[model samples]
Target chain A: MSDILLEIKNLTVSVRNGKSDIPIVKGVNIEIQRGEIVGLVGESGCGKSMTARSVMGILPGPARKSGEILWHEPDGTVTDLTGLSEKALRDMCGLRIGMVFQEPMTSLNPMMRIGDQVAEVLRIHKLVRNREEAREKVIRLLKEVGIEEPALRYRSYPHELSGGMRQRVMIAMAMIGEPGLLIADEPTTALDVTIEAQILRLIRQMCVSRHMSALVITHNMGVVSALCDRVYVMYMGRIMERASTGQLFANPLHPYTRGLLSSLPRIGKNPEYLTTIPGNIPEAGREPVGCEFCLRCSDDERRCFFERPSEIETDEGHYVSCFMCQRV
Target chain B: MSEEILISARNITKSYSLGRKKRHIAVNDVSLELYKGETLALVGESGCGKSTLARLLMRLIKADSGRICFEGTDISALSGRALKPYRKRMQMIFQDPASSLDPRLRIRDIIAEPLRVWRVCPDKTEMERRILDLLDMVELKESMIDWYPRELSGGQKQRVGIARAIALDPELIICDESVSALDVSVQAQILNLLKRLKKELGLSCLFISHDLSVVNFIADRVCVMRGGVICETADTETLYAHPGHEYTRYLLSSIPAIGDDPVS
Candidate 1:
């Protein structure tokens, strides 16, 4: 029996702008060991969110998707999510795998009470038999996410809460189903620095307590380093590198990964203008024939412009999709 | 230190009544200034009345019990057409670029709105030339003037927003978290532009942001706020080197940096 709770193989995604399928998540593979945190990190339009939504079967449609998203059950049942019916998908969606979206202000219903919004998830997932029991569970969920005066907060609307508090409410709602896997998509990007750190700490601690696996989608290196156990660096919808958190940060091997790490403003080290990846991300249709990151790679060669590098195992559990992995 | 005080606020107090007689004091006993060519950063967490202070300075909202002295006049009491001259000298760049700009307006018209409203140029032809110059100043090309807000990227939209704020070449440009919406790599460009503009134009800026690193880079002096109070104010170097307030210390310690031991 495999301990991997979720496995994604050759997952390719393309946004359907009318009839054209513009690929966002290029051929990718990821495995989330049960109760482990695997971070899919990259900048905007990098397809981190798309991969998470694919696993939850919730990517906004007119999206063309391919490859296997398999969720392993304790009873030896494996469910293939890509071809699941809409009703079946919804039934398994929040209950089996809940997601905390990027912006809580948009994700949360404005008119509903915070408590009722949370209870709606519980009732939808059939976690409680009656409204009273659901209410009790909702309060407990809110309390679990560190909402003080849960009873009072339950009656408050989403707008009444601060960004951090609203995110806490969102997290509570996500956990209503006691999901095996949780996907948090840039949960703190909209918040301030102090609130961001607080929210990250809360999510990390909560995931551990619930014994739930998480795949956090973020662009911020700081957030990922603080919370994630394993890290996957993505570019142009493709996974460029994957390693344990310590290994990835200490010695990043992929050219794209090195550029991103070097670009960041390190603490206590003053530098000139941030060392940026030279060019902007290519338009979806303009994705390169070989390496999507070749245009910006400082060590780019003629071969890199023509031949796509396949993911090679550099070390146990560490993978890089780059010819210069040995040197980078 | 500059010879002239470009702008100053004296004991600015603004309060709003919450339903009954109970009032919410948004800004209380606040006083600050902007010099001829210095960036005064207002650092605070949200709901600490930073936005209120910005609005108060701009006279978007009137201060209930204080004076905003611009140049030499107490313009807090001015309204409608009376305050037009003062409005021309101070421009505000808002928090959200997407919402701050009008969806219906094209890039040219949005930047030109202030010029047209103030009638800065003698004729429409001169206004077009001036608008193009402002676009170049913010690093946007001439062709972008025709594009709508929807056509631009986040960084592009923010540049357009900056162009609009500096449209009239205002003496004081109040940027309220202008780079917060941008990506980290993109943030450097915007910050650099602001710094460059300050030196080139001898512009005074009231740079407001929660990011201490950003403020460290641009601010000549910083006023750290917590819970609607000015916790501490000093020269940027002095404040960072020896932040007296406990909250200020806590804030500095919280900034995440790789490879350095985190402040415990």
Candidate 2:
């Protein structure tokens, strides 16, 4: 039996310029299964964050969003998040679909105590009856995320904690709601490697133990390989490739995916020079008419310059959007 | 690598007074050397004083007690005019390319600023020619010369930063997390550019980064720092294969890689 948690159909996010609307996320379709850790990988400005923000109903002002963000309820009810009002979406955000941002220092309120911030989510949802119950729950959640001396740390301000500790607090805030789906955007990009490992481990443990689905958005291939069950490679606001983690690492079909993988400096492998993708990502509103990556791709062909290639399934679960992947 | 030392630092210490009573030691008594044509990396987490140490070596900040020698000359105490000549020989590429560059200046002027200050070019035509040569060297298009910093992407802005850093043809370049702010593919491109520049110019580089994988790829030697002190120093192969210090081993093991088994 297939258990689908969320389905995004033809999602397009665009921001209005002076006269024309510039699309940031163009026709992205993704499905997350129950308890599956899925990764949305892309560089900056690729609209990965915008997609995640759209799910939480948190797109910035002046950005027009269109598409069906279907959220599957356990009781067989389907909710299209795009149609919901701000009030209704706010009601469902933390309680049903939680999110964790990259910069913990800025995401958290420096003025408030760490304990109160975590407790505020419960208070907003009316999950707890009293202040005492909220405090106890927040402390337990903090301990669960591997924070040492949770009780003592509860009263500390955001500035008192380290980067890793602040991230744990953020995770605690996200998980305290016990949402079915969690969206983490570059959760460990700001931390040290050792601290990053711990945070990744905590996120994985929380998801598995609770049977929760997670949309881990990051540009790091290593993070995708270490934490994701399935991955989507995004480029210029479009999903270029989608496959299982094992399959993606073993056989990447898209030129962009291959370039990303080969460009990374592996720990044990020391090459004289890394293989590089020439040229920079095109400026907004200037993307190529055909393939988004054609300008920087070494394998681009004649068709790649004039006609956009749709997604083609290369394997049972693998899909790639590239001209070379098409079976002649 | 040859034993000819390009720069050396000995017994360098820096501290900050915290609230009049408590003191924060940013860099303890540390000593290191950079060979004439080898890339040496200083790897550590945030607050490990890697940036402070780099600043000290560049003479951007004064060390409380240390001797900084450049080509067998103690240049630590040199100030004002005496430090001017050494400044032309040691340049730095900052981590944030956007803020490090002047937003108001055109790309050509940004690259030509150092050339003008150092008086490398005598006239306007020679300056324009030199700027074009620098743009070519950094793999940036000549069309970018007239555009402002806002028009270029992150990678292109970083290239401009590199062009400015190498305008005066410095012997030693201190890259403080230079590629950390870039995407992986662009980072690889910039790394390749740096490697090519080093080989072509025979430049000595002090690469400071918190990323161990990047260090392993670029550096001939590595120094691992923790809590303002050096914990380990070794050649890249020996450091990665057989880390002498416990902290270095932990850092190596903590790196998330493609082949690593899923934590769950």
Candidate 3:
């Protein structure tokens, strides 16, 4: 029996722009085991968000999705979500798989009281029959997310709370569903470092305590280092490298991954010069020939410009898609 | 190592009235110095008043009680015409270049606006030449001078912001979370550019950021702030290696690093 909680296989997402269907997430593969936190890291235009959205069946209009998104349930039923009806996918989205976005200020309803928002999720899913029961659950959920005054805060509107508080409320809303897999897309990107650390800790604790798996999407390597067990480095919608967090950081194989690592401004002792990637990530659909990273890669070979490299397992579970790595 | 003090803030305190009776203290009795050709970083969490302190130093927002001196000249009381010259000498680069810049204007005009306001350029030709020079200094091609802010990448837009800030030859520049909005690669590019420009122009900088790691890379000295107060101040190396304050330690420990165990 496969222990995978969520598996994405040869997933391709494309958007129609004028005359052509441009692939944003091209032939990507990812797997999240039960109780594991996996990361999808990339710069802007790299389709990290697209991949997450595709999993939730929230792709924008004019976009097309193909391939399988296998979600395994506790009952041992393997559901190929790609072929599921819209109603079934919607049912699976919030109840089974929860999501948190980057901006909590906007993710939450500004008009609604915090209590109603949290309870609304439960009420919609028919998890709670009465208002009083939902209220108790909302306060309980708020307390679980580390809110100081859960009862007092339940009556408060979203605007009355701080950014960190708002994010916690969002987490409460997501967690009220008892989701097996939580997809947090840049959850802490907008938060301060201290608050981000707190949120990351909360997520880690919740994942452990609830036996929940997570697919965290972010560009911050520090976040990946702190939270993720496994990391996939995506470039131009394609995953260039995938390995355990320790292995990926210790010995990054792909040039793009190496560039990202070296480019991070460390906490102490600055390097003489940061090794920045030469160019920005290419726009989706207008990708370069061969490897998407070929244009910006420092060690690009002629073959890199002519042929796409397949994912090669360099070591046990450490995979890379680079012609140079393949050569070695 | 004794060097000339470029700018100094003494006992700066700022507060805002919440509703009718309550006053929320944004910055409380914070004091620091920016030395000639040195980058001083202010590190803190959001709502800790680091940005408010930056604004206070820039006189963008007035402090309740404080004395700010630029090269031994007390600029705390100066206003209007008296503040104009000081304003020219001290510039600021904001966090969001996209919003900081005028959306309707092209890149060249945006850069030249500061020069025009300061009367640094004599004519259109000189201003154009100076704008091209500034673009070159920022490592951007002159051909992009005609492009709008939306057309440029985040790094490029920041470069434009930098060019505008330096157009008047400011001695001191306050960078308020300048590179926080950029991607890592572009952030590195902007940082390198800033480092190079600081050296080349002998510029002193007051760098404010929530990201301690970025502060470590760019700042010579670090001031750790919390709840509107400066908890600790030390040289960057000393501060990072051995932070004295508990909050500083907390902040340091929170920074996620490769191979480091997660802070539980």
Runs in model 3 lying further than 4 Å from the true structure: B260-264
What's model 3's lDDT at A31?
97
Instruction: Give the per-residue lDDT of model 2 (tens digit) for B155-261.
Output: 88999999999999999999999999999999999998998998998999999999988888899999999999989999998988888999998887787879543
lDDT of 1 by residue, B1-264 (tens): 596888898998988899879988888898887777889999988878888898899999988888899997889998899998888889888777889889999998898888878778869789889989999998888998899998887777888988888888889999998887776666766777778877888899998888887787778899998776788989887887788899888887666554333433
lDDT for B247 (candidate 3): 94
lDDT of 2 by residue, A7-26 (tens): 99999999999999999999
Q: Mind giving the per-residue lDDT tens digits that candidate 3 earns over B10-127? A: 9999999998899999999988888899999999988889999888888887889989998999988888888888888889999998899999999988998887777888788988
**DockQ sort, best first:** 2, 3, 1
Instruction: Give stretches of model 2 more than 4 Å off.
Output: B260-264
RMSD to the hidden true structure, all candidates:
3.0, 1.7, 1.9
Candidate 3 docks with a DockQ of: 0.62
Clashing pairs in 1: none
Candidate 3 C-alpha lDDT tens digits along A274-298: 7788876666676778999999999
Tens digit of lDDT per residue, candidate 1, span A242-265?
999988888789878887776664
Taken in order, the candidates have interface RMSDs of 2.6, 2.8, 2.5
In angstroms, give how far residue A57 of model 2 lies from its true place: 0.5
Query: What shift in Å separates residue B166 of candidate 2 from its native position after superposition?
Result: 1.0
